[model samples]
Target chain A: MRQILHILTQPNDPLAAKIIAAQRQEPDHQVRVADLTVPEADYHALLQEIFSSDSIEVW
Target chain B: MKPSWLLIITSDPRTSARPAEAIRIAAGVGTWKKADVSVYLRGPAVLALSEFADEFIDEDNYTRYFPIIGEFGRPIYVEQGAPRLAEIGESPMRYQEISDVELAALAARHNHVARF
Candidate 1:
């Protein structure tokens, strides 16, 4: 399985949802999403995800 | 070795929330001791480095990421000839002014580049 990380820069962006949903459909892809727009987001954990993921998509 | 991540901010901060978000990301990513993170401000986004940055911050989503970013102490890069450069005055952030060509080289040197 491939680790896929999705970094969201915008709030409520349909594109992010659409892309993540499509990625989830792939049986071999393990997807994770991080929304940076949240006031209390833990960026440190997000960085860990970013570095560990085989694929990263920013939206 | 840690991978270098460069965040390029070119949006108009006053008209958009992108600049603040980019900075927030930089601050968050900076916390990871293993990731080499840097920020590059060009165009109107350069304004975010100045004292005027307070005006562009999205208060609702802001967590005062500047101090965090500052504490990380990476040299932020600001492009020369940004629009209204004179009006912005001195920036509290430590930045080095680089030309467009230098910007290209800087981006090329990074392992990952994200533009906002």
Candidate 2:
């Protein structure tokens, strides 16, 4: 299944690391990680992409 | 540095950690940047000021950082008619009560405005 993981955290945050590890275990799921903490990240655009996907989980 | 900043946070910390984190970052940045920072809480965001805030989140402990932000002298305000104000008893931190009209006026006076 296509899944989008939207994480509103810094690049090096521990929570973000844990999320990346968890996503790796689900190899069958097509996952995209959007980090909102990045200065250049456009949250509205990312939200649009995530809402259009099959499934979305925010952290 | 900007003269003032208005950070309007409408997200409930119980539902997500982003709102609390946004408040923390905004307050810190505003303080360090020497701008007069004001936080306006509306909707569920008022919960961030409650003593029970720590119980809702397991990670990121955003409630703990709230006091540090307050120490910077950045004022935090809650909407006068926000429903969450009734849900969560007395606030642990200091905040002024402002009506929706006053919130708009506050925003208008600030040089920069951000919403989360």
Per-candidate Cα lDDT values, in order, are 0.72, 0.64
| TM-scores for every candidate against the unseen true structure | 0.62, 0.59
- Please provide, for model 1 over B1-116, each residue's C-alpha lDDT reduced to its tens digit, 9 standing for 90 to 100: 77778787878888899888888888888887678788888778777766655567583333387767777666778877777566668666677888765654554455566768
Tens-digit lDDT track for model 2 on A8-44? 5545644334434555555554556677777888878
Backbone clash pairs for candidate 1 read none
Provide the RMSD of all predictions against the true structure, rounded to 1 decimal: 9.9, 14.0
List where candidate 2 sits over 4 angstroms from the true fold. A1-59, B58-61
Q: How many backbone clashes does candidate 2 have?
A: 0
Per-residue lDDT over B64-107 for candidate 2, one digit per residue giving the tens place of the 0 to 100 score: 56666687665678888777787777776888888655654455
Q: Which TM-score does chain B of candidate 2 obtain?
A: 0.83
Query: What lDDT is reached at residue B96 by model 1?
Result: 82
True C-alpha contacts between chains kept, each model in order: 0.00, 0.00
What is the alpha-carbon interface RMSD for each candidate? 10.1, 16.2
TM-score of 2: 0.59
